[model samples]
Target: MQTDPTKDIGSVFGRSWTLLSSNWIIIVPAIIIGIIAGLIAALVTPTYYMDTSGVYPVPVYHSMLGLSLVVGTMIATFVGMLANVVILTMTTGMAAAAWKTGKAMISDGMDALRRPNVLSAMLMLIVVSLVLSLLTLVTLGLAGLISLVVFFFLIYTIAAAVVGGFSGMDALKESFEVAKTSWLTTLIVVVLLGVVAFLATLLAAAFHFVPFIGPIIAAAISGVIVAFFSLVLVGEYNDLRGRAHPAVAAQPPFTAPPAVPPL
Candidate 1:
């Protein structure tokens, strides 16, 4: 396994930002797809109306599919999730290119979709999501903590698929190995990137009220954030690969030394 003194979570995030700012176009596809998916969802989802009763007005929900609302919602939701996966796979490819070569084009993103076994990667994602959902339900939400840990462990599966050309199941195994090798660092990356994503979402929410362009602007912002998150995952994957899994309580948590020396 390979390790570096200056490849900590902080530097991974810093490098991701640098790559993202320069290759902002990498997020265009994601933004476009997000808008399309949102429109599709809006068209398929139901709306609520105000029903005036004798003394009050109450909100009455109406599904476009009437009695089949649940089925319709599931189909719409699956389509949205599929769109999200496609966007993430493309962005991961672009982000991987940008991280490695300091540049990437939209075509590079498209090329990632052409990679063999990409569908398997998508299937693995669905499996993981179902597992997490089942865990949450079975444990009455106590499994939230376990789900987070599972998330941290498997977070790099798509990146591995994109960067290492691993198939879905293989990528999951690889990600687990890398996460085990640098468990602490992986945990930190998951938490910090999560925070950044949360903050970016809050910022993007402000763009939704800006008229016709609001959705576009919000999608762009969200696309950029998602791209950066994917980029950092690639970076961290590179940082942890080849390193031996640390024995519990045997070594200090991984921390890359700062780039600059303090006087």
Candidate 2:
């Protein structure tokens, strides 16, 4: 069994920032792509309002199935699938770069996008999200508390999928091991990232109220959020892998001391 490498939560964050800064060239474009995909997803996503008080206006439709809902669902599902592919491609590309060179690149990002397994990763993302959502509803919002504790483990799945080409189940299993070994660190990082993400969100919301530049800034913030969070996972994975398989020390050669010539 591979030993756990993660030791310091603070170091992980530092490494993540280092990686993100080093890969700014690639991350910038990737962030833009992420923003665009998000926009597309929003455009296609189903929108409906329900009211038990009968105060809301409902869409007019003749069919019992509600044509608007059917069409919206189909459109959203198709667009969402495509969007998932795009997003995973970007993330995996960064992960691949991190694995290979401890850095990131747009080209590496593009290459990773071409891999077939990114689809599997995307599927895993969707499935896990749905499961979590259902679990949340079933538990009457209690799952939110549970997720606050274990959601960090999901980052491992993404790392496993990208770096090792592991399938969803394999990623999940491996993630559990990594998470088990570094639970405290994971918790700390997750909490910190959550705070950062929250701050970014607030900033984005503030920017949303600005003029034209405000929208652009908000979009940029969204992309930054995605890029930073994903990059941190890459850093953590690198740390974990290093700890598990440290470099072997080379054997020292025997050397003879110079003979005394003064005698």
How many collisions per candidate?
3, 1
| Model 2 residue 186 CA deviation in Å | 0.7
Residue 223 in candidate 1, Cα distance off native in Å: 0.8
Q: How much is the lDDT of residue 55 in candidate 1? A: 45
- Tens digits of per-residue lDDT, candidate 2, 32-86, equal 6656666776775556545456544443323423675666665655565556546
Q: State TM-scores per candidate.
A: 0.79, 0.70
Q: Lowest summed-lDDT stretch of 10 residues in model 2?
A: 244-253
The whole-model lDDT of each prediction reads 0.79, 0.66
Return the top candidate by TM-score.
1
What is the Cα-based TM-score of model 2? 0.70
Looking at model 2, residue 54 earns an lDDT score of 52
lDDT of 1 by residue, 125-174 (tens): 87777677667778899999988778778888888788767898998898
